[model samples]
Every structure is written in C-alpha cells, then in structure tokens.
Target: MAMFVHVTSAANAPRIRRSGIRAVSHGQGDARGVYCFPVLPSYTLTHQWLRELARFGSRGGLVAVHVRLDDDEEVLLGRYADRARNAQATVPAAQAVRRIAELDDPRGWEVFVPRAIRPRELHRIRTAPQVAGWRYRPDAHGTRPCTCFGCRVRGGYGARRLRERLPHPLDGPPPPVRVLLARVAAAGEPGDPVVLREVLHWFGMRRRGPLDRLAHLAAHPDPGVRKDLVWAVAGWSTPGVGDLLDALADDPRDEVREAVEAVREPE
Candidate 1:
C-alpha cells in the first residue's frame, strides 16, 4: 500500500465528505496512520483529484496526499472478486463490479495483458517510478530456478555444497541461495528425487520447498537435513517413490534412521 503525506483538509475535503471514501496504507505499520477520505457529493471530483495527487500530477497542492481503497473496494474491485462475491454485502455498499461490465462492453478500461491473466493471478498495479526498479523483474539477479532436477539440486545450494555433493561446475563464490531457491521453486518438480533431496538440504539454509516432496524424503540419505525439510513440506502427505523411501527407512545407516524418525514423529 502507498501512503499519502502532507495532506490538507481543503483539497481532500470534497471527496472525503462524499461517498465515504477511504484510503488504506497497506505498507504502513500503524492503522492510525491510515487516512480516511470521507465521501462527499463531489466524490468523483475528489477521486480525480486524488488520482492526480497519487500520480504526482496535482498542480502545486497537497503534496504526497495518500489515497487508498476501503476494505470492501480493495476486496471487490481489486481482484478479490471471488471473496467479494462470497461476502454478503448490501447492494449500495457492495462492490460495483457490475460497473465493470461497461468496460468489457465495447469501450471500457481497454487494458489487456499480453497473456491471459487468470482469476487467481495477482495483479499488481504499479506507477512509473515503482516499475523503474528492474530489480523486481524475474531473473534480474539470476534468481530464476533451474528446471532440471540436477540443476535444481545444485542451484538450491551454494556452489560449495553443490561442489561437495554433485557433479556440476562450481564458479567463484557461490551465488546466493535465494537465486538458487527461486530457480528450484520455478522449475523443481514435486517428486523428483534430486530436487526433493536438494530442497531438503536447502531448508537448513532456511529455505522451504514443496512440502509433500520433502515429507516423502523423510527417510532421506542425510538425517539433519530431513529434520528442517519436514517443516517446509508440511500439509503434503502424498506418497513418493515408496521403494526408495522404504529402503532408506529400513537402511542400517544411523543418519538415515534418525532423519526418518524425526519426520515420522506425528505420523
């Protein structure tokens, strides 16, 4: 959420008193810091003005005046349509999603994404300044996960861990585990043995992977890694390569038994 500061009552008074307009600062820690733009008869007018203020296009007035959607508007108009529909709201107070019908009907918002945006896809609307940060782009810092299971295992750990365990090239100081984890997150399969094993090891670095896969590896080769991996793989209990896991479960290896016992505690 964005915060608007240095706001005066005059510029915002019209919309503030109309339509019971509200501004929510999503990033602000304190609720008291949230500014409520009261609704007025001139709500549409104030809304235009607030939009200008948010865009820094307002002429010489109300610098940094924050404007945000009320709880219902955010939930309804801001992509939480399912939640809004599920919520029982009065007609006037409910989200005016029906108004959006006008958008799809001939001439509307006209802003279509290059790809189909699913209902579950999160839509983040950012201003020019916010979008200027290329750091937020995917693969900007090479954080993209490797799709291959071997690559995922190697990528999830730093170059050092990977060098010790696997047959992959190790460049200088290892890339941060975050970059590797992101790669794994994007490409690592839920049930692949190498991906699952690497994910388990990576959790010790405080990175969690797909849970059920980790649970399947509860009887993995390494004991300590399994302990932390279990937490990451919580709520997923699907059986995996049972023969492999069962073998690890019955293995004479002390490390293997310890890890399996830790994960199978509640089961």
Candidate 2:
C-alpha cells in the first residue's frame, strides 16, 4: 500500500486524511512514504523541512507540493525551483499520488526523468480541468483583474483597482450574465464558490446598474459570500451601493467587516 505524509497544520490534517490518503505525522519514522506539502502563507517553509524533503526525494521517495502562485509567489516559486533542481518531476498533487500508487518501486524510475514538459512550463499553463463545468470568459483580457480568493489574498493593487473601475455584467445585454445572476439568486444558502466567483467577475465586466439582486445577497450568512458581494459593489457608483456597503461595514464577522471597510465609501 502507498503511504502518504502531509506536512500541513494540524487543522488541515483531518481534511487531508478524509481525501483517502493515509496522512502520517511528521515524526512517525516512516521515511519511505510520499510527502505532500501545501504551500500556504500560514505554513512555514523551513530549511530543515527542505533538507529532509531533498533527502527523501534523493532516496526515491515521491514529493507532492501544491502551490498557489497568487499567494506567496516568490517563496513558493523558490521551493518549486529547489524541487526541480533535485530532479523530481513536479506534477499536480493528485497526479503525483496516482503515479506513486502505480509504481511498484518508485526507485525504479530514474531520478532525472525527463518528461514532455518541464515543471516551469506546467506552472505557466492555466487550465480549468480542476473546476468542472466551468468555462473561461472568451473576452477575458490577459491583463484583466482577477479577484479570486488567491488573488485577493495576494493583495495586488493593480488587479484590485482594475476590477473596481470595471462595470457590472448585469448592466450588459440579457444573455449569459442575466442567466448567471438568476442562478446565483436561486442558489441555496451558503453560495457555491465557483458560481460566486463568476458572478463577481460579471460585476467587474460592466460599469453601471443597481444590481439589486446581488445587493440582496450581501447579507448571505457565509462570510466569504458576503465579502465577494462587498467587492462586487465597491466599484459601483449606482444608487444604494453606499448604503449596502455601510451596512456590511458593521458585519458580525471580522472578515466581512474588513472586506467591506477595505472598499467602503467615505461617509
């Protein structure tokens, strides 16, 4: 059986194990298992861990590291560079685990195995396979702003300002944007992240309109949904936008309050 080690916070250990991987503790003395690292800002990337990982990989162990480029870009990039320098093919977490499972003896594969694409190339390629039933906007500009969770956490001013100045999709013709808004309104409590993201993007695509329906969702119980709603309204100069933001500025959740305050209009 394939053994897996997750080097993340204790809080995330349960979630990792629930995914069917036998998450072992760090000091379990099981050095033969594949080690998985999640590159989050909260996790400290220490030199000791790097050295241990290098030693493990050198001895034919698999290493799977999931990186969010929008957050801690330089740090994660440097770690990934080290992994590539060590001759480990950096594949996605899921793919890496599958490959490890298929191999009877991981050591059989050469350390410097050359694949069709390098890790850097794979990093540059952005695809939507991870998000099922979602499609990229055909008209999306390469320089267009992204307000997704990762981008927001990264806190890029250019992207945030561009998104703020853009218009709302609801202000456009009644096609996909209208259809998407309807779905968002009809969605049950605690909205879906994918749908919410697209809706927020739509809000950033057009400049004028009340978007009353979205304003109503500002009171969503989920703080994340409420935060997205705040961001959607931050760019609008339409009627009631200020009042809506004012109400959210005092939200019970600190995250919601911070998000609203970040873009709230001066009183």
Candidate 3:
C-alpha cells in the first residue's frame, strides 16, 4: 500500500479534518515534515504540488490530503531540487512509492513525512486544482529567470516590472542617469551590487545623478547598495540631501540604518 498527496490550504481543510496532517515546516531552515507527492501514474504527476502549494494561500483555496502509507512507512526521499540537500534521506514507504513510480520525470520528486498524519492514515480531502502544479520550480517554464540576488523576490508583486522586462545580467535594466554618470566617473569598481541596486530604483525619476557623484554611495559596501542608496535619495530636496542623510545614519546595516530613519522621518 502506498498513496500520497498533501497539496494544502483549502483553509487547511477543517484543521485537516481535525488533527491529522500536521508537521508544519516553512522557509528558512525547512524540514519539520509532511510534504507529500507520489501517486503518479501521472494525474498531472500526482498533483505536482498544486501550483507550488497555492503560494502560501492567504485566501486562495486548495486541497488534496489523501493518504495511506503502510508498506513499511518511513519516508524522506529527495529531489524537489534536493529539498535543501543532504543526500537520500531515508526511504521505505513502499520504497518512496517505487521510487516515484520508476521516474520518467517524476517532476522533481519530494516526500518527507517525519511524524503526523493520523486521522487514521487519512485518504481523502478533495477539491484541488487551484491551477495545478509548477509555480517557481520544476522545469521552470522555458528558463531564463534566476536573476540572482538570491533569486530576486524582494518587494515582489511584479517586482519592479519583472526587473524592467527580463533584465538581470547582474540584475537590471537600469543605467542611464547619463550612463550612471559614466559609471560614477570611471571607477575601479562602483557597479554590480545587483547593478547598483538597480540604479537606485530610479532616484525618484527624471534623473538624479550628481551630489559629488552621489555622495560616494554613502560608503557603499552593499547593504543592498546602501538600501538602494537610501531608497534613491528618499524624495530629495537636495541641499546635499541632509548630508546624504547624515552619511546614511552611520549605516552598519539594519537595513541601512532603518533606511536612514525612514528618510529622516518624513521631515
């Protein structure tokens, strides 16, 4: 016996039909348990992680619990891009369901388990397909993304219009405050901190180039390029923008000294 599904978040199906599928583990340091996928005689590769776990659902409904491990239960398995790699973590549960049913692209395998699943080995929850699998991984549709700065997603929603329409050579499409004032006046290295924080997210538009060549990027040693040069000169009223926000409020990076006191608390 071997069957699995998981998918999740139809408002967690009534607390997983009361105390059943709980093992919760999310982001940074992942691996607490209960991450399924394996029933594949391909029902879309057995619910390939329903649109990447319905992108952390805050209202976006999704489901699919289904269970029943039995065959020497004890899983861990691998490769959803090496679930934070550590090599073939344990096995058994019917040999990780016959090693992803003899994979011919088991769409990036994954199977965890490590504890909770009770409500008598579940076996039903239903209503899935909130736009089926593959969102930010697995065969990442036609490639070219990984824009690097740890795979881009800060301030996400359309993230700066997808980095100015597919940019990212070192992350950007930003460069013309007259060619960044000729690369900060022909320097030995003033550039790539993700393209100088994408050209300081447009120093509040219509060009803002010199202040002694942007006050030496307030000692820029990359706190995301001095929090994008204190958020592109936080609405400058220039008079050396308060001594470049007092030399970036002595930034040692608490997000560039809290964005230099959120740009001097809205003056």
Candidate 4:
C-alpha cells in the first residue's frame, strides 16, 4: 500500500523517505492513501486539515498518528471513518516502524495501533541561560521502576559496563575505541535507535582520535543519528567540526539546525 507522510518540520522528511513513504504537501488534495502524521507539540492541527483527514477517512483512507509524549510513553492511533483504534507501548521508534511495515491492509491497522490513554505531564527545571542545562526531579514517593524490555536491558550492567570500557583520551587508541568505531561504521540500518544511541553516547564521551573517525556519521541516513551526532560533536574545537556544523546548518530538519545553533559560538 502506498503511504503519504505529512510533516511540519524538515527533520521528519528524511525518516519518511527512508521508510519508502511519499511526502505530501499540507495543502495537497490527492492524499487519499495511507496518511501518516508525526505529532509534535509545536505544531497544531488546523481545522481544514482535520476536515480533510476526516474526509479521507470517510472515503476509506487509512490514517496513522504517532505521538511521543515522553521517554517512557508513546501512542499510535489509527482511524477509519468514525471508528478509531490505538495502541500504547514503550516500543522504540525503530520497532514501531517495523510494526507498521507489517500491516498489509486497513484491517491490519489495529495491529499497529492500540487503545490510547492520557499521558502524565512531565516537568523539568531549566537552568540559567536556558541552554545551560536541565534539572529533572522525579516524585520520590510515586516513582516506580520502568519494566519495559529496553529499560530492563539498560538497567542491567550493560550501560555501566560500556561506560567503564570507554577508553581514556590520554591513553591513545584503545580496544574499546576500536570496537565502538566499528559499530559506528556498521550503523547503516534505518530506525535502529538502540545501536545509534549507543554509538552517539560513545562519541559524546571523549573528543579524541576515535570521535574524529566518526565524523562521517554526521550525514547518516537516519535523522535521529544525525541529531545525536550534532550533539556529540558540539563541543569539539576541530576545523572539521566547524565544517560539519556549517553543512548541517542548512539541514532540512529544524531539529538539526537548532542543534547546530545551540553549539555555535557568537562571532
């Protein structure tokens, strides 16, 4: 089935293209196929757009809505006519894309969408300068352990072990650095959030030789990877870093441009 993705920010375009979906203009009239919307807080659904989507649904077009409320909660909605189906799961974006790819028809929409629920609002304290940093304080009495598979795996010794295994900048190239760089080289699959996050974390840790080797990932096919790479290279003072930031400044994704602006020093 042909899929059409309607997005507000250029950042979402690369992901849609990688998914083999066509990008449709907001005012396009021929979007009568599978409609996909990536809901973000900054964009509001206009009345005309809503009416058009409803009309598309009434005409038997399928609608897919993906919402990421926080790190812990995500909701996917599917609507046809007045009937709606949704699914709430802690699956990463990559897994969600795979689930959507499995559906062959409208009848299988619910398989990708589940029933939705109201998400709890999250609040964080912003440090001075707004860009300086953030302080997150969870409710001590109400806090509970996350039981999602990814959380469980992260809670294990993996993160700790990885941190411990990272090579010291003064030690020159180390075994862990080689291994991490190898993973960075093989991170070509679309929507593989886990691998990309790990690679980004490793690159963010030290600004030594290994990080320089990963400058190529700045143009990774996955926007998520590029976003993380921008953050990882933000603090570097290398000449290549400046050129990389300049190239990414014109990126279609506003998120990438914002990241570039964040690290860019005033002239």
lDDT of 3 by residue, 1-267 (tens): 788988777777888888888887752155577888777766887887787666645454787888988889888887866755566578888988887799777776788888778888888898876676687788788987765567776665676777777777654545567787665555447556765665566554433446667778777676888777877877766667777778788777788888778767855
RMSD after CA superposition, every candidate: 18.2, 18.7, 15.6, 20.7
User: Sort by lDDT, best first: what order?
Assistant: 3, 2, 4, 1
lDDT of 2 by residue, 1-267 (tens): 111222223343334334423333232233223333332222222111433333222323322333222221111111222443544554544444345445543321211112111122122111111111111222233655455443332333344454456523444322355776776766655677667766775675455555676776777766777787778777877788888888888889998899877775476
TM-score of each: 0.24, 0.33, 0.31, 0.33
Evaluate residue 228 in candidate 3 and report its C-alpha lDDT on the 0 to 100 scale: 74
Which pairs of residues clash in candidate 4, taking residues 3 or more apart in a chain or in different chains?
11-253, 86-113, 86-114, 86-115, 87-113, 87-114
RMSD of 3: 15.6
lDDT of 1 by residue, 1-267 (tens): 211122333454444434322444333222212322222233232232233233333333342233433224332222222322434222221233333333332111111111211222222221222121122122235564333333343433254554545433322223355664564566434444556445444444332333343344455444554444543443234344343344456656676556556656785
Candidate that would win on lDDT: 3
Worst 10 residues of 2 by lDDT: 125-134
lDDT of 3: 0.74
Candidate 4: misplaced stretches above 4 Å? 1-175, 188-193, 265-267
1 against 2, candidate with superior lDDT: 2
Runs in model 2 with CA error above 4 Å?
Answer: 1-176, 265-267
